[model samples]
Target chain A: DAGITQSPRHKVTETGTPVTLRCHQTENHRYMYWYRQDPGHGLRLIHYSYGVKDTDKGEVSDGYSVSRSKTEDFLLTLESATSSQTSVYFCAISESFRAEGYTFGSGTRLTVV
Target chain B: AQSVTQLDSQVPVFEEAPVELRCNYSSSVSVYLFWYVQYPNQGLQLLLKYLSGSTLVKGINGFEAEFNKSQTSFHLRKPSVHISDTAEYFCAVWNTGNQFYFGTGTSLTVIP
Candidate 1:
């Protein structure tokens, strides 16, 4: 099992509210990623962090922001949650080039009503 | 840029039967490939990956995949399967510079 954990295994909130998901890794990996999994759409990347404060947008990065102030912590925040934003969120960590394999967290199921 | 395709969305087979999950990818340059499995209500776990070297890469749980450079395919195969093998399997590819891509995933069900 990976040393990664995502906070709030399940959450429910109203539309237009702000939601923040936290991913913590005990391995101290350098690369962290956020992805959302939906039926038919599979899993799509939202954002990733290479280092502290170094982040970039992913294929489906709109309305979402990520921050990595420390090596073991990566936070993903939805500025304003919408019904469309409801999905399972997964946090993953990998070493440079992904030589070994990525470590994934248990995932957070977010529901926006 | 890289993209992965898992042709079979669902595959049902009897326990002890052989099975294969097809995955194809597109990339302009040489790339890395991976397979991950997710059980019901569980996190995704790494099954196998192909970074370099041999085209046939073996993973945990008696699973293996072949990376065909010419066909741009990385199909996963197992000679025999168990009921515990039922799960969602995903195929992923990564290009140079760390850009990664994943397929829609295939759900495998093993019957008793």
Candidate 2:
């Protein structure tokens, strides 16, 4: 409800395929983050962007890559998807460093077989 | 580095019963604390946050949390709960800069 949208709400793909998930925000927030949710894992940060063309890796960034070419758009790409990468991906936007709360997108459920 | 711990994996309570969710954090420097809730098939929503000031913080849906510096804990509580209150709760911590960490989460089920 924070004007955040994630494309391809649900996807099922075979292993070794390429997949890209899109997160678009109308709020133009300065900070954007990508996270993956798995059973018993809560949510693990995959990657994040501070601004356009500025990105940083998170704790679980091994199998994923991210790009933020525009302020409102942050993209997450899986070069070659694997069965282990199957999880619910969420995008979050925050206005400030630690003051305001984050606004999260609905989420994208990806299943790899 | 900052980390959060939610002790309970799942909690079940009858309707109108009081419930508590325990949360603890560890950080060398000062940190901000937050609580988030997620209903089924929905994204996480901010329940409440402790930035500064009073140790006790009240959030939406009749939920409240207490931030204890000495204890390194931020426990969430509600006096009465409804069946609609069944959901997953998360505890989070953030440092001065940009990184944010979340706990494993606790699933609360309100039984009738």
Candidate 3:
């Protein structure tokens, strides 16, 4: 939370419009993740970056894309925002896969109308 | 692949009472377990983690969890919970994979 920050803490967007959420970390963690939280679904991992330009899709990565050109930044982009995509999105950072735990950002609340 | 399940969706407890949140995971390989807490409209915070040895792990806010590999359970406990502990608790597992699997979460309510 202290080292990771997500931009546009709150956002309202129209359907079919592309939206991008940015996550920046000062701790220089090697791992970064994007997750979406919803009712009953908990936190679903959208995507994760292991290093610069090295990313992988998570369980729910169909409509989302991510990029990590820099170690300090990981961005999640929705191809076309939909009502189902309206949820609280969180960004987390970890030094390694077996590190202590993840440090999460405040989160971005997105509303699609 | 790894998956986590939180047995209880909600648990209501009186202040100063002891409480436990149950969690079980399904992973073929060795696993790393963790517990997280989330307040309203906030991100999840690390409560505790079980990376390797020592089955019993203590976390912040007087929270502790025990890792039972036999039953594949990692249950969180607090001898005396406070009102401030009222929040949503999540149990997660991360194997040697690309991402961590999280449970639906358990809503813990502390009554005064």
lDDT by residue (tens digit), candidate 3, A47-99: 99999999998889999999999999999999999999999999999998754
Which digits, one per residue and each the tens of the lDDT, describe model 1 over residues A32-97?
Answer: 999999987778999999899999999999999999999999999999999999999999998764
List of chain A TM-scores, every candidate:
0.96, 0.97, 0.97
Instruction: For residues B1-112, write the lDDT of model 2, one tens digit per residue.
Output: 6778899999999999999999998874788889999998889999999888999999999999999988999999999999999999999988776678899999999999
Q: Second chain only: TM-score per model?
A: 0.96, 0.96, 0.97
| Candidate with more favorable, higher TM-score: 1 or 2 | 2
Clashing pairs in 2: none
Largest TM-score belongs to which candidate? Answer: 2
Clashes of each: 0, 0, 0
Query: Pairing residues by index, what is the TM-score of model 2?
Result: 0.96
Poorest stretch of ten by lDDT in candidate 2 chain A:
A93-102
Candidate 2 lDDT tens digits, A20-70: 999999997899999999988889999989899999999999989999999
DockQ of each: 0.61, 0.68, 0.64
Candidate 3: list runs displaced more than 4 Å.
none
Q: Write the per-residue lDDT of candidate 3 for residues B15-107, one digit (tens) a residue.
A: 999999999998747788899999987889999898888899999999999999889999999999999999999998877764578999999
Candidate 1 error regions (>4 Å) = A97-99
